[model samples]
Target: MKLLLLRNFVFTILQSGTVVGLIPFLIVEPKLNDMLTQQLKISHYLGMLIFTLGFFMMLICIRSFAIDGKGTLSPADPTKRLVIKGLYKFSRNPMYIGVLTILMGETIFFKSYQLLIYLLLIFIAFNIFIILVEEPRLRRDFGKEYLDYCKKVERWG
Candidate 1:
């Protein structure tokens, strides 16, 4: 149990760094004065609030995967059981939604059109991956139970 938790925690950090940390650096340099590239006039407070909400959403989904699914979110160490509790009840892909939400918040906060484009590209890629890979694997692994859950939950909400 301790080993599992440690593995999950380490993988979670790596995944979060890749998705929520490194990607942003590639998209845009954080700057106090983004006057040259600023495309939106979103309030700073609003951006922070959105970022906080996104972070919380991701945390909840990660916790659900660890506790209820008895697994980590990493593809190499995926859930052992089908998880349909919490945000999963609302969206079959809440984890993706949470990541996209974080990207959206970054877009607003950075006021970077490049970041916005990156976010859209990421969304499209995730949609394709879910449709072509993840969903099929779930159907195969969990069979009728997964199909039923798919019927109940929106892919993204």
Candidate 2:
């Protein structure tokens, strides 16, 4: 419905902003001149490609959440159904992987140890949140169906 889509849009924006938008870049400013002394480098373009893939992966997951699961990324408005399609078929937390991938790309591009540390912190936080919150809620909401999916899929594949 229109209402669900609207809510999804709003929450997606909020989460995306915090996870992959200006916040991280604000924290980790890359020096262009120092990024690579030599002219164009493969790692430079590779970083962009990785970033694009990460963003594309996120879009796919968000679409799956909305169309297939009737949900947003926010815990307050989680998926009504378990999403086990596309990337979900491989990993239970592909959205988080997408986020980490984006961060990884930024770190590689910037060559910033601060960003790398930030990525590690984010990963730890995500893992804790998933273990303490998301997984429990999924078990409560979807019960055996979710457990069965967990059996079939790798947690972080």
Per-prediction TM-score, please?
0.89, 0.90
The clash numbers for all candidates, in the given order, read: 0, 0
Off by over 4 Å in 1: 30-42
Instruction: Give the best candidate by TM-score.
Output: 2
Query: How well is each residue in 47-141 modelled by candidate 2, as lDDT tens digits?
Result: 77888888889888988899999998789899999999999999999999998998888877776788889889999999999999999999999
TM-score, predicted candidate 2 vs. hidden true structure: 0.90
Q: What TM-score does prediction 1 earn?
A: 0.89
Clashes of 1: 0
